[model samples]
Target chain A: MTHPKTRAPRVARIAGLVLVLLTAVSGCSSPQKWDLTNITGIMPQLKFTLTDQDGKTLQASDLRGKIPVLYFGYTNCPDICPTTLATLAQALRKLGAEANAVRILFVSVDPARDTTAVLKSYVQAFGPQFIGLRGDQKELRYLTKRYRVTYGLGKADAHGNYEVSHSSAVFVFDRKGDVRLLGRGTDPAKSYTHDLKQLINDN
Target chain B: MQRIHWQKHVSISGTHGRGSMMLALLLSCAVANAAPVPSVVITQARVRLLPGNLPLAGYFTLTNDGSAPVTLTGAISGSFKQIMMHRSFESDGMSKMAPVAKLTIQPRKSVHFRPGSYHLMLMGRQQSLSVGDTVPIQLQFKNSGALTVEFKVVPVGAQ
Candidate 1:
């Protein structure tokens, strides 16, 4: 029974309220600020104590103050391991002296086959600065579970011929030892370099 | 075909003139066309140099030029104690290597065995191998017979 002019004002008021509500909802669901997928809080604890390429027992805490790029792979991995390590080497080469600020950790999931000496030579072949880490199956399992890494061994024939499947993503940790970014094995070296530079600047 | 064509032209030139030359040219063309082409070709054979006792990775490209498909059953290399075909795959962030029993290539197709995909795992080096060294590997195929190809040893970081 209201006048048309009065009803128009009332409808406008309701529309204005609806518009404000929509803006609030949209703002609450805003996209992340970083280019890479944000996995900041996914893994809260990145602690581990494993043996390095030098056969020395090292703790993750020992690598503080330097950004660590972690990868889970084995030496016998003819494809992904070499490819990923090569990509990382390329990125480090592009960074030049800045590469020293970052540490590359190649965690061998195949502890049975990849010995410290084997890992040392394998990782050092890519870059002398690269550190190879390996541990027992239980220790590796704990670390893999903490980082959500999955790895399994293929069935071996009579000739001791088998393959190990593992995760290929490179987990980048900041100087503070917090997981920051994830780099894929297939990503170009430039992307890794870019991310590392940004992380260096941020840290 | 070229040898036969040359002999035919020489005899024809002694007997006849332009007409005989044209006939000889046509016959040579037909013979050349009928010649069998190479059914399979291997290219880009290279091996990665990994230090210590780690297995080396060999990569190559196999091209089939025949009308029928070809299956690569296995490979043998005297330089390594064992050679096996393997494929690398990544799914849901997990990277895995699986044994490739046999790979079949379609007619007129090529299968690339590159890094992070398919490769030959050469294990237990028989002798010390270094960069610039050439290792002979024999590829066994189902239809195209065995092909012995030389895989040049490349640096570990080389793609």
Candidate 2:
């Protein structure tokens, strides 16, 4: 609405100032997180309280403000459970000092066999840093449901041998208590590590 | 069959629409001398193959029918760069897997492998693997000499 000459110069001056400000702020801008954008879809919501291996009561909230890799299985479990945990132990050892910041949680789906004492020995065999947790059947069901993890109880035979069929997905929780991503299987692969590396870098 | 001693069932939840139950994992611990043992058949044998890593892993069970000790040492798998026997151990509460001289299979005894415990390391993967793929492996024992074993490709979380 104003005169052409006056309007043109005013607009130019405003644009020039905006460019200068952007240049000044760009240098101080923070690096964007790759994990946040890549794995934005599968956020996990899990919270439960159970007895720890040390016989102390604990809750999911206590694990807040740190990255945690959690799995659900039994101690007397013949194969995959132990195999996966061992891989985690190997992975953690490879992580060295950085591993200190990460907490690996072993949630016992078999509450009947996994008493606090049983969990203690089982987790201790995997890694000193591992935390084994056991709860009543109702509590375990609630917690597993929150994570969308599936598991089954097998029927007994005359000889009394039984097996447990369970989901082998590994859930990763960020420091903010958001379930960021899932690494499929009992043990992760290089791709899993790559994804994990991305999540760690985000922190 | 009479020589095989199966352990009792343990209860646990099931996954994959396999309803909750008290499942049974049959194990044979007895080694018989008077009776001729039935040869062990390890079905659904497979390894979790990791690309670019040496010494991948293979897990299976020992079913004895001949009633004698067998030393599993020599093995050949086209999928791996190398094949070897290794036992994974948990020490100081940390998991450690290392190469071993041999794995002894007692007469009429069966050994099982799962994650974080005893398993066969594939050493290295020669090709890429997918969820539904399968790789063939050959296992050789000190006494059995050669065994053609095929390992099914399973999810990392599969038992």
- Indicate which candidate wins on TM-score: 1
- Docking tier of model 1: it is medium
* DockQ (CA atoms), all models: 0.56, 0.06
Minimum summed lDDT over a 10-residue window in model 1 chain A is located at A31-40
- List residue ranges in candidate 1 displaced over 4 A: A1-36, B1-38
**Candidate 2 docking class:** incorrect
lDDT string, candidate 1, A1-203, tens digits:
76998999999999999999999999889843544545776675468999999999988899888888889988877778888899899999999999998989999888898888888778778886599999997888888988888888889877786778788778888888899887788988888888888888775
Error of 2 at A174 (Å): 0.5
Tens digit per residue, CA lDDT, model 2, B1-159: 122232233444457343332122221121222232235556557665332232345677766545677776756778766665656554432233455667777766777755555677554467877657878777666644556665777644344
Backbone clashes in candidate 2 total: 53
* lDDT per residue as tens, model 1, B33-138: 6542336777789998887667888998887777888889899978888888988887777887778999998999989999888999888899998899999988
Candidate 1 docks with a DockQ of 0.56
Candidate with the greatest DockQ versus the true structure: 1
- Give the range of the ten consecutive residues with the poorest summed lDDT in model 1 chain B: B1-10
The local lDDT score (0 to 100) that residue A184 gets in candidate 2 is 45
